[model samples]
Target chain A: MTRTTYRWAALFLALPLAVYIAFVVFPLLSSFYYSLTDWNGFDVNYNFVGLANFEKMFSDRLFSNAIGNTLIWTVAAIIVPTGGGLALALVLHERGIFANIYKSMFYLPIALALAVIGQIWLWIYQPNWGLINATLRNIGLENLAQAWLAKPQFALLAVILAWSWQQTALSMVIFLAGLTAIPQELIEAAHIDGANYFQRVRRVIVPLLAPASVVVIALAVINSLKSFDVLYVMTRGGPFHSSDNLAMFMYNESFQKYNMGYGSAIAVVLFLITLAVIAVYFRQSAQVERLYD
Target chain B: MTKTIAHNDRRAATASLASDRAQSSRVPMIIFYVLLTIIVLMYSAPSIGVLLASLKSTAEIAEVGVWAIPRSFELTNYVEAWNGGNAGIYIRNSFFVTIPATIISISLGVLAGYTLSKLKFRGSNALFIFFVAGLFFPPQIALIPLFRLFNDLGLYDTLWSLILIHIAFGIPICTLILKNFFAAVPTAIREAAIIDGANEWQILTRLMLPLSLPALAVLTTLQFTWIWNDFLWPVILIRSDEMRTVMVGLASLKGQYSVAYGVQSAMAVYASIPTLLVFVFFQRYFIRGLTFGSVKG
Candidate 1:
């Protein structure tokens, strides 16, 4: 390819590049710099504490709670969406109007904002007249019904279920796309070789859909770890910080409690974790592209 | 190369229904229907529950629960949400934020993407990396400083701040997707245009943009949903209720109408409609955009 010469390229990229660098790049780097300082949210004068902000985390219960909850979130992200998506994808793998309709039905949840999903789920989990409680009562399990979000024990799980509903739809769509890419000949051959449907799925379909599964799992981890919307709407990491993931905890600390430095530290920790995941995501996605391409 | 197969897949989907039905056994077909029926009901239940609740009286909702069939089909709940509930203002605010943000970001991304993909320029790779790096980490890392920056720039608590932020951050995915799409166009076609006395601006606008309408549609639909559905940025950046986006408005409705389940569901339905409408009408483009990076990934 020939170089398109000096001024034209510069002219073309100038505006977008300027805005992007000013907003996204500058703030991201500044966050790392600020993570070392003891700057309260409104303070102009602040001291640099190096790793001291990071060091205080060992004794911080809320930090531990956020981390543990984030871990639970990450683990759930890996399992639920991936498994459910793969299952749905397999069930709806056939080509037809029926498949398309069901596919869209599953995909519908992903189209809604997490805030809306949170509201819907919040109603479902409401104690007195909520769907879960009402259904539980109807089935003769009145004792099982309780305030899902008000109690610390069930809040995170409730939020995760709400989140997973959307995520599963995403995973299903990805898996369906992956299933589409797999050559029909292979599955046909497995059937011709006397393999049953389940056997064909186990030996042919699942293994062949590996690339899609990688994307699904990676996205689950990424979206879950980075999640703030649903939690913010539903619990705000609340009813005693039980539902707080890193992002929510960081928000409460930085925005509400005014622990900007400590919050920035948490943001850094989150960045580091996400960086590792993104790195893996890029590698796996690239490898998947190569394998599929 | 992949596009050909994708095209064939679409064709196959529309034409292969009879063959697909023939290949499967009666038992498996029954299982598929049963499974699909159960899953469809399960999947649609939440929204249906909310929809039903939105049509019922608050007293009826309290008496019958969200799951129970409603006796009252009240439009009063919707009327309340639209007028008294501030959903009307929030919907207007959302449209203001989403439409401009989506259009401007995609336009700028088109410019930057064309340069990055089609031209050999110094620092192009670095520029590409600069934008894409925005996608690697959570936005929380940038929030505190952006919070300060927006305040300093006096863009805080307004639609402008949210719009500007969406555009700026949107560059990453926009460039990533559009550049890859543009890169697939035969370089010879661009060279031919250049040889025919066309300038860069003319070629970009006349040749590239027109050719890439499908790509633009995919990008537009996705960005619209993302910008419209955005909650976190608006929640933190805007303080005033008048400036609130639909999401923040919906959240506030929860706090204000804690016992008014019908009102809350109505607001929830309002918040969901724009994105849901996009999905309904542009299902192909919506799915294409959602699966774009994943399949590419």
Candidate 2:
């Protein structure tokens, strides 16, 4: 290609590159800079309070709870959904009947906007006449029923259950793909060696499908950490801020409370934590990168 | 060889297989059906319950158990909700913000992705890595600076502000996904186009863009779904009721009508319809698209 053509291609490239740098890259750097100062969001008269916001973050009770809940949310988001999804996928795949119906049903919640899900579950978690508690009581398990999103102990867990149901469909899809890729010969071989279905799954299927499992788990964890909509809607990080994740805390501090610096500090910490986990996950899955293609 | 193994076990295997078939068929099918039904109930309960409640009067909604049949099917709840809720305006606001954001983000993403994958430019790897790292950075961190940035630029409270934010945040991951897609395109085609004395612009426009239709379609749907459902940026950036996106509008509605369950449920269902239609249309490709943006080549 001559210089003229090369210049045209570069011109095409320049438009997106300029936008990317201005919006994404610029804001990120500015946020980092703002984390060092005490700027009330709307104020014009603010000075750099070096390390003060960071100091407050270290000692803040809500920040600590947010971090702890964020960790729990991440773990439960990965574990609970992953187990349920794989189990569902295994059952649906073996049956090969009503699979499409099941898949569509499972995926319904994911398609709904997060606000809608939050609103739907808010009613479902209503303590007195809510379906969950009422159903338990109807079954003569009255003691088992609880105020799901109201109490501090069960608030995050209840939200996680809702999220797990919504998210697991994607995991199931990934698992189904991985399951299809596994050579059917291996499963037949295991069956010939006097293995039952359970044994074949354990011995032949799980190990071969480890990559898909990792991808699902990693994605779930990241998504859980980034979750804001439901928590923002249902609880607003309330009942003593027990439901507060890092994302919510950041929003409240920066926007609601008007503490931009402290909020930026919290946001930075959350970013570091996410990056660390992803880094570790990638390192562990190095041998399988070949399979990604 | 595979057929011979089955042949060797003809008699004993036939008995065993018959027993296996009988046992597995009757028991597991029932168990599977039960389990699947339970799961379906779990998933569909809230949505169905909400829809039913929305159709019921406030009194009936309050009196009946969530799963119970409504005493009467009343359309007033939906009619009143739409009028009082200003949902039509909110829906329009969402379209205003979502459409431009989706187009700009996808277009920018495709360009950045195409350049990085197809063209041998200086610092492409570095730029791509930067974008990948952008994925890991929580949007919370940037909210403050962005708010200030938008305010200073006098772009606050408008759909354009939200569109810019969405495009900016979306590009990194979108570009990452598009880069992988462009990489997967056969280089031989490019070489063939080059041999025919076609310049990069003509070749990319006439050749690459046409062949890359599947990726373009997938990216468009993904971006459309994402922008339509976005909550945080719109919520923070657009504070006025008139400028509010549907998510924020729903949030405001929820707060206002916390006691009015029927009205709120009706509104929730209203906001849910557009995304539901998109999901139904792209149901086959939804899973692939979701995984494609986040995962590897």
Candidate 3:
């Protein structure tokens, strides 16, 4: 408010601004520049290839596969986590036996790193004597159980399931918080108006949970788009890159194959998609801000 | 704001409607229980199996199915993981990185958040957006540039690389949390303090900081967990076994000890324990932080 305070403001803001610009803002802009060159991470004397990297992605089969897998993950991200979280939040919204413990049990995965989650599910999907096969044999459906992560057809889906385990927990917690904000009187009012349970939930609860859904769905979309760690730990985008999303694809291209330029192109594409989704998130969340106050 | 949400949820959970038809409630209640049972099993079964398998030899796990009870408890699995598997060093490196990073980031974030919240200086909105925009950008976009930059600084393999990177990247959420929080405190107190000749720094350190401990707790728990569990940057940046975070070490262990299932499981448990402690003790703060940061509650 005063001249001296304005000086303090500058002092306080200076450090964070410098660090943020150095680490994040500068590098992010540089990624676009680097994407246009043929830098293989070692040579200081690479040519500026001017959109060649982006053009190469047009015909790359593995790039196509990565996009396909990303589509699957993004679609699954929209449906599975949203559905599971909403269901759990609704169920947990009502009191039950050991409700607190159940809530913790589900939320526990969210705390663990995706790497750990990948390991746990790796054991669960191990071909021989693993949990899936063991249970399948016990139930006399041994044919149904196989190496879930090894099969190219199943590799991406298996990894998606493991990631969904953690993400679903996140969604559930957000929805539970959303559920708290709903007025019970609205639900009760509908209940007394001859509306069935499903009708009341459909008309009152779900609609009112709009703010939470925006957040949960936005998170799911972003998390799925950033499908690197879990896939890295689980499959390494393996069984011949069947599980490769843009991140894994980029890593494999840049780090493993030493194609940093192409990887940067992929990164640019991934960044653009994420930027669009986040822009939408900002708009929708603006509405949620209005709804709150 | 967070208090009302928690309070309202408690009431919602405990105060079920009495006017509901018994028949209408019963079917879905049964369905809910069934789904809950399935979900509980889905969440717990793999973990329980991993725990069981971790207590036995790989040979023994193969002899009996992984879901089978261990014939003998091999507590040595943890030792093997800790020493033979190098989890001990990984854990040390993680703590060395996570603790300093968390403390430094929170302090810097508070400074930025306080100024951005109350100072009303020119270009403050742009500065705030500068940090907030970081939240939207994917880490991949910065990978090549960052890798080269770190090498240039000669901090490539050292822990400082991660500590600085985390604090810089963590600015966005940290500022958002504290800014939203400090903004909520009555401006009259700030005005009063100003009239008393108290400076901005004094008001923040004495008045705002003490009043905003809850927000700090939320930021602390969330930031600590996130930095501790981070994998992408660590894997790319750290080289020596001595410098790898526990998550990167776990990934390496999986490659080196793929046949040693028991050891792998033990290391997985070791990797998850710290975050589990955060979850166990700060469950309330953890959930609240998640909502407040993302949903801006």
Candidate 4:
């Protein structure tokens, strides 16, 4: 490239690059530094604690519970949404007026903020007058009614259900796009070969949808790992911290408790987990792309 | 003669079977529609409940379930929700943060995305990858340090803190989308513009940008929705009640008015309207932005 071209490019890139480095990169590096020290966020005379924070995390029950809950959240978040979305996509992929309306209705939750969704679910899970319990009573199945978000056993599951509701819309949309991309001739050929509806789906549709599934699964996994807003809004990892995930644990520890070093350690761990997931996702997606090629 | 008769009989049997199959398919089709209706109702229950509850008095909400239509519409719930508390200020704060953040991020994203796509300087690929990698970094990692950094910079309790954070976080996806978008514009257009004595600035502003209107719309809507719906940054950065975004305000409203489900529901409805409007009006672009970002990346 010529010198003027070079100068123009530099000018174009200067502001974004500077802002990115300042806000994103600088904080990331600072988190790494803070993770190893005993800084209380305000005190400058804090000691270098080395790996003590990381070591302490292993012995901390709350940290362990957070890890476990995070895993549960991630697994459920992936499976429920992917499976439900795929089913919805299959059912709704056909063109019709009703199908279009159903698509919009299913996608309605996507537009609402997570905080709002959480609050809505929170009210829905209220014990006395909430929708679930009231519906249970109206149906004469009052025995099934329980405090969905208050009980330790049910809180995490309740939050996951809400997350699933919001997440499935995006998954459905992606899978619908994937389904649309499939050539009509393939399905027609399958039908001409005497393949039934289930047979056609199994042979032609599902296999071809692997790429969309990869994208959905990757997004679901990453989103679950970073799950915070809904949980924070609904239960705040309440009823004995049973619903707390790693993100909540980090936030509570760092911001709430002001344990800067420990929170940074938790942040580092969460980052590593996310990085690992992204790496796996990239590798899997690359393979999927190769298959298409 | 017997062979001809047999062939005619087989044809008749096949026609009968085809008719049977067609008739039988109608049953499943009916079942499918029924199932779809149930699913739609189930999916829409919460939103419907919230909307209805927002229109009901507190006593009505308590007396009857959210499923029941209010005997009298309490339109005052919305008025009260708006004027009663900090909900108005919080929503205004969200707009203050969302609008400028959207404009700034999209502007920078266009410039940077255009440069990275067309300029092809050394390390451009690496820089692109760097920005894309930002997508994977969980915001929790940045929270504590960003808090301290903003505090040190005296932006801790201000709306600018959330604005800057949103812009910084928004760059990756915005730039990625814009880069892909600009790349799709054929090189011939740029070459012709250059031959016609247009500079890079003029080419981008006058020639390329108009062509990229769809992508720009997608980016603006997506970024606006994201920044508007953002919860974490506002919770961390803005301490004052007046500076809080809608999500943060709604969350706090949940605690403050735990007993008054009517007002809380009203606030929920109020908070959802802007993003909901975007979704309704720009539904195609919204879905396109989502699928494009995920599938292409």
Interface RMSD values, listed in order for every candidate: 2.9, 2.6, 2.4, 2.6
For candidate 1, the TM-score of chain A alone relative to the native chain A: 0.95
The residue pairs found clashing in candidate 4 are: none
The sequence of per-residue lDDT tens digits that candidate 4 reaches over residues A103-202 is 9998898889999899889878989888899889989999999998889999999999998999999899999999888887687668657888899999
- The sequence of per-residue lDDT tens digits that candidate 2 reaches over residues B1-297 is 978876676556556866888886997777868888897877788889888888888777777755577878888878877899888898899998788888888888877787788875677798788776777666776778888889999999888888898888888777887888889899888889888988777877788788777777777777777788888888888878989888788889966777778888788878888888888897766667765633333
lDDT of 2 at B17: 69
Name the candidate, 2 or 4, with the larger DockQ value: 4
Task: Looking only at chain A, give the TM-score of model 3 against the true structure.
Answer: 0.96
Candidate 2, residues A38-112: lDDT per residue as tens digits?
888887888899889989977888899899999899889878889987887787774555766876787787788
After superposing candidate 2, which stretches have Cα over 4 Å from the reference? Answer: A1-9, A290-293, B1-24, B293-297
DockQ, every prediction: 0.63, 0.57, 0.63, 0.63
Clashing residue pairs for model 3: none
Is model 4 an incorrect, acceptable, medium or high docking prediction?
medium
TM-scores, chain A, per candidate: 0.95, 0.94, 0.96, 0.97
- The candidate maximizing lDDT is 4
Model 3 regions lying over 4 Å from their true place: A286-293, B1-35, B293-297
lDDT (0 to 1) per candidate? 0.87, 0.80, 0.87, 0.88
Residue B50's lDDT in candidate 2: 86
